[model samples]
Target: MYRAGIDLGGTNIKAGIVDEQQHIIAEASVPTNVERPYQDIIRDMAELVKTLLKQKGIGETQLKSIGIGSPGTIDAVHGVVLYSNNFGWENVPLTEQLRQYFSCPIAVSNDANCAALGEVKAGAARHAKNAILLTLGTGVGGGIILDGKVFEGAHAGGAELGHTSLICGGEPCTCGRKGCVEAYVSATALIRDAKRAAQQYPESSLNAMCEGDLSHMNGKIPFDAAQDGDTAAEKVVNDYICYLGETITNFVNIFRPDIVLLSGGICNQGKKLTEPLETYIQDKCFGGSKAFIPKVACAVLGNKAGIIGAANLISGKER
Candidate 1:
């Protein structure tokens, strides 16, 4: 039997047909074109899945289940998207709509959680029964997997690791909170701090790297300049590491999972990013060196994690 996974995003709707072995046998995608009506988006999603199955010459009955990774608050038990800022969607009957096209068990979950599940089923955390994944992109998004199953809390809005407060009342977050982990650990936050550093010291190499235009600065500029021994850039890089380190430490103290994975552009820094964080978590976590310190690594599946994980929503079982 095969399962279908759909990754619904603001820009695109992606679908895949995966075999029992967890490998994607076929895939299809369509531009979400968020400007259209919700019905249109759903139609596109349904069509994409149909196209993939057709391309593989697989019958509809061959698909044992279909899973969707949707953004925002999800009522997974009911297959509804409670809210999605990206599409201005609220209380959307996602699974109900899809069932009109495909007759199978459909599961809808937070995209972040699906990503975590994907990593566990086939990616970096495959060997670990419990793991955490933090994606530090435009905003910080994360998922918690406990005992080989996604933990959705009582309300299905749980495990929003990014929105958790990192500072009591520091930077404002997009979620209307003050000093969320997203406010400090996201790539946007890192770039914001880099631009500020560039403006503060006109003589800094960062200023030269961005060519005196702060808009040109990105998450990589600081790390690159720091490696070249630029004091201003080093300070910015160190500060980012400190904030991220402390944040991971706090999570470690709470979950103490088998491993913690970091995703997003900043992870491109490789060990330059994970090494320091490992050292910090080891030093500051509750048990210090005597306790089990989760290994920190970068997410390997990249964009595919969402699709693979979504499919596992039904096929996956708790260990």
Candidate 2:
């Protein structure tokens, strides 16, 4: 049987059709235009699904279910988006509205969880039964997969790895918390560090990369400067790795998953990022490499992870 996966984002709504093997057979997307009413967005989502089915010549009777990966605090059991700062949404009955257009079972969960699930099913952690996925983007979002299933905990609000405290009272976080892992390990955090480093070392190449405008610096500036052997950029990159190492080690001690998958633009650093991260995690993890060491690697699926993972949620079937 086929299933439909919808990835709802502030900028776009992406949908895909997946077969039993978890391969996307067909897909489509549209601009979200979130300024419009929520109902208009939902209607567009329904229309997107119908358009895909029609393009593939597949009947609704042939599909098994529909799954959605949304941002913010999702009430998965009720298919409601409790809140989404990205869309300025709260208490939206997303699934109930979609039901008016289709009759199949529908499941909804946080987009981060969906991305993790996708990695477990068909990406970097495809071979592992228990794994964790960290997406180091504007924020450090993550999800945990235990025994080949997404672990949402009570209220479907667990596994919010980014929000966990990294420092007792460090930088403020968008979540209204102090010193969250996201405050240090995310791309935003990296940019913040780079800007500070530029101020401290006026001779550094990072200043030129950002045209001396700290506001223009991004996550890549520091890494690029570090590659040129700039001491200031090196320090920024090292400090970022240190916090990430601490967070990964925490997960290793707690979950002991078979593998840890890293995603997002940060992963583009490739070995420059993963090599040192692996070394740091190896030294800091609870048990040494002698006993059940978990491999840390970059996620292979990229953007497709959310859609594919959402589809997997409907059946809870692992490849």
Per-model CA lDDT versus the true structure: 0.90, 0.88
Off by over 4 Å in 2: 317-319
Residue 48 deviation, candidate 1, in Å?
Answer: 0.5
Report how far residue 317 has shifted in candidate 2, in Å: 8.9
Residue pairs clashing in model 2 are: none
Model 2 / residue 205 / CA error / Å: 1.0
- Model 1 stretches astray by more than 4 angstroms: 317-319
Model 2: ten consecutive residues of lowest lDDT: 310-319
Best-matching candidate per TM-score: 1
lDDT tens digits, residue span 1-319, model 2: 8989999988999999988888999999999998889999999999999999999999999989998999988888888999999899999999999999999998888898899888888888889989988889998888888888887767757789999989958999989989999999989888988998899889999999999788899888888999999999999999998999899998888999999889988888888888888898888887687756688899989878999989888665332
Candidate 1: worst 10 consecutive residues by lDDT?
310-319
